[model samples]
Target: MALTREPPAATVDPSNPNIVRWEDIGLTLIHNFITEEEEAAMIEAFHAQDPQKEGKRRISQHFGYHFDYTTFGASETHLTPVPSYITNFLPRLPIQTYLPDQFTVQYYPPGTGIPPHVDTHSMFDEALYSLSFGSAVPMQFRMSGPNDARKMRLPKRSVQRKSDENTEPASSPATAEQTQANAQAQDAEEQSACWEILLPPRSLLLMTGPSRYGYTHAIRPRKTDVIDGKTVPRQGRYSITMRTVRRGDEIGCNCAYPGVCDARIREEMAARRDGAI
Candidate 1:
């Protein structure tokens, strides 16, 4: 009889402090949150489309390919939208309320992954959660500045500008308050530790506290992570990045996937509990 291996129970516990598991900020899985149908559909479309990848080292935007609730229109279900696979479980998890109101999909094909970088924005906290699908790839979590990552695209002088350019962390600000604020703000930029892990398909990675805000994470150079001794080159992959973003132009906004709309928005939840979303 062929033994069947069950999928890793979708987990959302606080990241481990000793090594940063998933229990640092009180995150536990409320429910699996997403269905096989939804996951398969998204993966199928993403692979079929094969969005043009800007390539590795592109820090201005998504390195491989990009799609998200804002651009794709994912405000149908509750628990803060962006689909339940990534964000809905946060409320029950150890992670405190400071959640991001956003969720994005990232596609990484062979030889493609984000360079070492930190995701910062007023609307986004220090954490980044990822749900991978389609294929397996190793995501290199690292601390990169000018010496670390060669290319960067930090666009603002505010919290978002995160580059090791002409501006040093200390010289970036002026007054003492500004310095303290900058130091406090750039706490994650100064980190040096990094972890490299293979994000398998149908798996979830929630980065919080320091992992999100403490240090930079990157897709390290392409290499084989000796699994069962079979060298696995990178393959096309997809992810459902769920998070909480401050409500946007709720009314004017609409679903905008160049691929598929799956539009069923604006209908009240009470009217339809079919769970098609």
Candidate 2:
């Protein structure tokens, strides 16, 4: 497939130096990021290793840095050597400098799905990357809020990015005042802008910015996914998640995203209000 060209100059967001926006969200999905032969080679390599069972639903293996699957933390784990295949491929990616230091291979059987949630903030760097193999699945993204949540789907065989303004994690439980305000704010604009990308087999996803922090992404638990009015059955799936761990003890971050930054909150406690944005 031809390279998915960068967005035309007119579509680039002046306010966000890092992203090319479509509507209010900044995400780019590069179709056919990997070849079938390469994907097959990865699967073969994975099968050659002894993968550890994660809880009861997933079998996985970690390299470079061991991550606590339940807590999604890696600060204390000892760093180990990653497989040559992963390290060799990392530098070939477009965002080579953001290359991952840790990767996990997760195997999910049919009917299994990941719950809706954002990757834990502060524990990992801004960019989250995933490589798909074995099967194709539609990953869903739903905006988190008190009002009706909108949905988006990720197609297989593509790479997606989450840009800066939308990197905050989903909001916590709302107070009574916020609930009331959310009820009142249920207009067209309030409807969370949603996006869907078809991630084919051998796809890659790099999530950053708001799409990484602001919305929640999950895979619905079922045997089939409805796409374009056609039902597609789930198959055995494998996902290789790569992330760069954040170092040091937790402290106030100075990032510009007020939605998820504690420093911004402490600095403007009294001035902030519900729906201030």
| Total clashing pairs in model 2 | 23
Candidate 1 C-alpha lDDT tens digits along 134-217: 777766554344432222222224424456443444533457675566555444443434445566666556676545543455
Best by lDDT: 2
lDDT of 2 by residue, 60-135 (tens): 7888788865445674656768877677677656576667777888888887887556665566777788788788
TM-scores, one per candidate: 0.47, 0.65
Q: List the candidate 2 regions with Cα displacement exceeding 4 Å.
A: 1-24, 51-56, 146-195, 249-277
lDDT of 1: 0.46
Shift in Å, residue 111, candidate 1: 1.6
Question: Residue 105 error for model 2, in Å?
Answer: 1.2
What is the lDDT of every predicted structure here?
0.46, 0.61
Residue 108: error of model 2 in Å? Answer: 1.2
Clash number for each model? 27, 23
